[model samples]
Target: MAQVLPPLLDYEQSYPCPVCRQGQLDRLILMDAFSCNVCHHIFSVNLSQQSICLADRTPALGWRWARQRWRPLHHPDIDFPLGIWILCGGLTVLPPTILWVMHYIFPPLPDSSANSFPLLWIGVVGITHSLIALWILAEFYQLPLYLSWKFRLQS
Candidate 1:
């Protein structure tokens, strides 16, 4: 069956730039502000008041100084990757060592499938440990970006 699609609309109508009155919307650069390539102006749009203001040139030195002074004192959140590495390293080494000792002291029955147990146990533990580590690393990697965005908003 043929499906009819809606007509294409102009970019300006579809996505008007929040900063400029007549400029076509490109992409949102930041919250409350957008850069107009055509006019080479950064406009600030107050969503609450529905007003736009051209960005002014403020000295960025003060912000840099503040960040340098505060960042040192504020302990950034714990890095998940390092934490996971420590956790997984311990998990990977400790269990197998204990299991190995147990196996040596109380050997598995000759007829029992005890011979294969350590290998399977180690494999399962290693895989689970690696998966958990990867998950933690991925979650941790996103923290910095989120923290930066949050700090930016607060400032």
Candidate 2:
């Protein structure tokens, strides 16, 4: 069976917000633009191209209206490649594993608290690296936390 592509949305209709994914994009009164109730983002609609772009940002963020959902439009300059994902994963896992292995291979002296394996430090390092990795990935992936701070600063 052949798949049919969704028709472009008319200016009168409401669609899901591409940025927040939680709000409906309602058309603004006396204007051709749309705004999301949740994110409060203004979007410029292009009927000819069948797309909506974030009106306030440079290097415009945009999405095309599919029948059931919005499809994100990609910009090469903003997209991170596979290498960055790999690096993030490494940053999340490598340091903790190395510390664990070192602790196991060179056991701390018994009855000497000062020569302990420093398990708290190991956990701290793991959590810190994991948070850094999560933050980087979230920013690139456009997660809610990153978007909140990003848009907050602009406002």
Highest TM-score model number: 2
Off by over 4 Å in 1: 1-74, 77-84, 143-155
Q: For this target, which candidate reaches the highest lDDT against the unseen true structure?
A: 2
1-155: candidate 1 lDDT, tens digit per residue: 94332233211222333222234434354454545543445544444432344555443111111211111112333223566678767866777677777778887778985778876886787677677765565454435554456446766
Instruction: Work out the TM-score per prediction.
Output: 0.37, 0.63
- Candidate 2 residues lying further than 4 Å off, grouped into runs, are 1-6, 75-89, 101-114, 131-155
Evaluate residue 93 in candidate 1 and report its C-alpha lDDT on the 0 to 100 scale: 74
Predictions: Cα RMSD each: 16.1, 6.1
C-alpha lDDT of all candidate models, in order: 0.47, 0.81
Candidate 1: residue pairs that collide: none
